[model samples]
Target: MVSPMLSMNQATIKHADLRQTLDTLTQTGYHSVGLWREPVEAIGVPEAVRMVSDSGLCVSSMCRGGFFTMPEGPERRAAIDDNRRLIEETSAFGCTVLVLVVGGLPQGSKDLAEARSRVAEALAELEADALAAGVTLAIEPLHPMYCTDRACVSTLDEALDIAAPFNPKAVGVVVDTFHVFWDPNVLRSIARAGREGRIAAYQVCDYRTPLEADPLLSRHYPGEGVIDFKALTQAVAATGWHGDIECEIFNRAVWDTPFDEVSRHVADAFDKYVAPYWPAE
Candidate 1:
């Protein structure tokens, strides 16, 4: 079997410095890393690019550039402009995919359909710029739990529908195990995304029980929780996806561990639970 390239998402080691994270990833044999926009921006895009490039590691994807559900006003316009800048940054880093966590309802509003509609409109507005920048806008469907605040796009199918009107090269879907594993139709959605050629990124992380108060940080490493990594990995492989499988956990416990040790654990988990499902050579 030919294992997919493994990538470490910056969120996995949120407490570590970007340079230290990159260094640890390289030392642990990760071929690439997924960067978070906040940290990358904190270091300045050019320097962040230089740091990763100097480490000889490729960027798998940039963690987010979407939040268009706000009320139309300066805030909304600013969000779009910020996303455009994020697209440029992704291009500057030579990364092809920029993950988008399309925002949920505007404050004091509960109309999900409206929020979803706004997301579609936002994608249309950014599609041309995404193409121009050579960056694919990867719509990440966060778990239903995040539907009220983080992302209204809560399933791969919903994300695909949002990307349907645009060229796959300009818009695609992110298949994140931690978020989509609970979906009854996820397997079908994966197949559909593959057939449509809109699977831009595949992120792997387990879902823990007794969810954290801030569920956003509830992600666990592969095989550490209830996620059936074997099944999910096989499903992704069945789609003929050959992209990097990023390990992006947000657990505070994992973050507290030493970055080097965390890197080793991530590599071992990928080899154990994920690599076995790789398509045969």
Candidate 2:
């Protein structure tokens, strides 16, 4: 089997001109992308689709659409419906997965368990629509720090449990290095993801020290920090996976840099850190 290719998450270079961002990726030799929702809306999906397709870049996954942990009512329904639309948009782009962040606290609420329940309820409602659209919803477990405001599902174990009821091919987990590296159970969780056939997407970024001084600046490029990425890569590949190894970074400093340079830097770092682990026959 061929090695998994590198993919650029648009948010990493989101500060750049949209068209130029796509062009920069193509010029830097990346053929896959992971896009955030805001830019798609800003540029209009039809035109964005055209830009990606014309440039010969495949969208590996759409960045978001799953903040269902908020207060229930029209707002919650709207979130679910919006996800359905996102799935339709994913279908239009011929992308496979819609990355679900699962959401955090709602308004004045601070109950983590309640927030998680909302995510479960939302998934139960949205799964069928995703299956119909042939779009997989990859539940991304954000780090524990993000638990209060980003995602209640902050570990691979919890993510897998939530995804257990659905068809693995339809609803799955997005293994992001930044989030799972801190989990002592990550290796076992990854093995379980492979065993249960639920590893929908796999990404890697290095971890920072101090872990809290600057939250946004915590993520490092592959091989730049303490993550045992080689082991993580092996665990992911043990699943017999053949897909893009997406680079999903969310560093404020990195974002401030020119978008084109960030794209090239991501591609180069991926090549240096994860490329060698691809099976060599």
**In terms of lDDT, which candidate is strongest?**
1
Error of 1 at 10 (Å): 0.8
Which is the leading candidate under TM-score?
A: 1
Q: What residue runs in model 1 are displaced by over 4 Å at the alpha carbon?
A: 1-4
Worst window of 10 by summed lDDT in candidate 2: 1-10
lDDT of 2 by residue, 45-87 (tens): 9998998889888888898988888787898889989999998
TM-score of each: 0.97, 0.94
**Per-model tally of clashing residue pairs:** 0, 0
Q: How high a TM-score does candidate 1 get?
A: 0.97
